[model samples]
Target: MEKISSTKNSKVKEWVKLKTNNGRKKFKKFLLEGRHPVETALEQATEYEFLIVQEDFDLGELAEQVDNDKLILVTKEVANHISDTVHDQGIFLIGYINEEDWQFPDDLSGKWLVLDNVQDPGNIGTMVRTADAAGFTGVVFGDGTADFYNPKILRAMQGSQYHLQLKRLNLEKWIRNCKDQGSVIFGSILDENARDYRKIDVPDQFSLIMGNEGNGMSERLIEMTDMNLYIPIKGSAESLNVAVAAGVLMFGLAG
Candidate 1:
């Protein structure tokens, strides 16, 4: 393992760049934060790049659980220099992220959730974490969505991204391809034309389409859905947070 102590190092600059969409694309890596998520990656360490921890943070039980050779120890100043969050856990990991090489299951026939342009890393991560819990086939992220490799997204995903097939796709080509696969597309909406999400028989072979928090589903996606569905709200909050709505929908549709 390598130890880096300088905050001004070039590799540290590159890791900071990985925080952004363009940098992740250029470098082919993403940052992972917190002990839980780092443990998740280390669970599959053979596939991961390396752990980046600060001089000050605890390695947790991971020191006994994982190989020490896989870790990249750096100074606390180096961690603060590269982290997006102010409250640093003093530990971050650089996982190999490939935006262009998602390998889907050959028999991917089941419930799925499609993200249109979910900008919030928290929302993206929560949905993914729950999606993993509920056993959806996978998640397909369309253009304009937050960087899937963002540290926050990875952290929020809680390592569930490692378990499921995650695809970054061009909306048109993806939808067209999925049509042949046995995926019936369901779009979440509020319009009267939409049916209560619980009423429909969520196709065992389909993807539920969700869009931006404020805009709802895209017009094009709505037109393509086998059905439009909405959760019946008992409370009056205008609408559910995208992440919350997704968890409710995923359970209802797939559970």
Candidate 2:
């Protein structure tokens, strides 16, 4: 194992690149900050690219659990340089990006969450996490959604990504495919014509499309859905946050 004290070290700079999506794509890797995400990675048996830690962070029993060959000790300055959060736990793991193509499951009896143009990283991550909690099969990230490896998104996910399938595909294609697979696709929209979410009966298997934060679902996708459902708000709020709305719908429809 190597001890790196300089932030200017080549290996340190390479790790820093994992902070950006483009950089992550170029390198085919991403960084998981702190213990929880790293613990999830370990539980999933994700291949270790590097296990970096500050000099003072005692490995304790954890040192025996992980591959010592991949371990690197770094100075406090170097740890700060690679970390995105102001208060990082002084430990991080470099893990490969999940680039495998996720096929539509042969048995389409499971619930699915489709995110269309949801730009907020926290919202995107929270929805993914909620989808996992609601027993959804997977999440399809449509075009214009935040990159899966964005730091804030990863932080928000809290390692739930390991528990569910995530894929990026065109929403139109996904919608058509879901229809062809005998799966009911419900679109969440705010239009006057949309049925109140409470009126719709939850099915054993379905695809729920949550759309952009500001504009709601696009017209083209809306037209393709079997039904457009809306959460009726009795309160004065203009609309529920996309993630919050998704939690309500996922639990109501998939729970």
Q: List the residue pairs that clash in candidate 1.
A: none
Residues 1-255 of candidate 2 have per-residue lDDT tens digits of 889999899988988998987788799888888877877777788887998999999777677788878999999999999999999889999988765733544555578898889999989989989999988899888878878888889889888888888887788888777778788999999765789888877777788999999998888988999999988888888999999999999998864
Cα RMSD, model 1? 2.3
Model 1 earns a TM-score of 0.89
lDDT of 1 by residue, 64-161 (tens): 96557867789878888888888878777777776444544466477767899878889998888888998887888888788678777877787788
**Model 2, residue 22: C-alpha shift (Å):** 0.7
Candidate with top TM-score is 2
The candidate 1 region of ten consecutive residues with least summed lDDT is 99-108
Task: Give the residue spans of candidate 1 off by over 4 A.
Answer: 56-61, 64-70, 99-105
**What C-alpha lDDT does candidate 2 achieve relative to the native structure?**
0.85
How many clashing pairs per prediction, in order?
0, 0
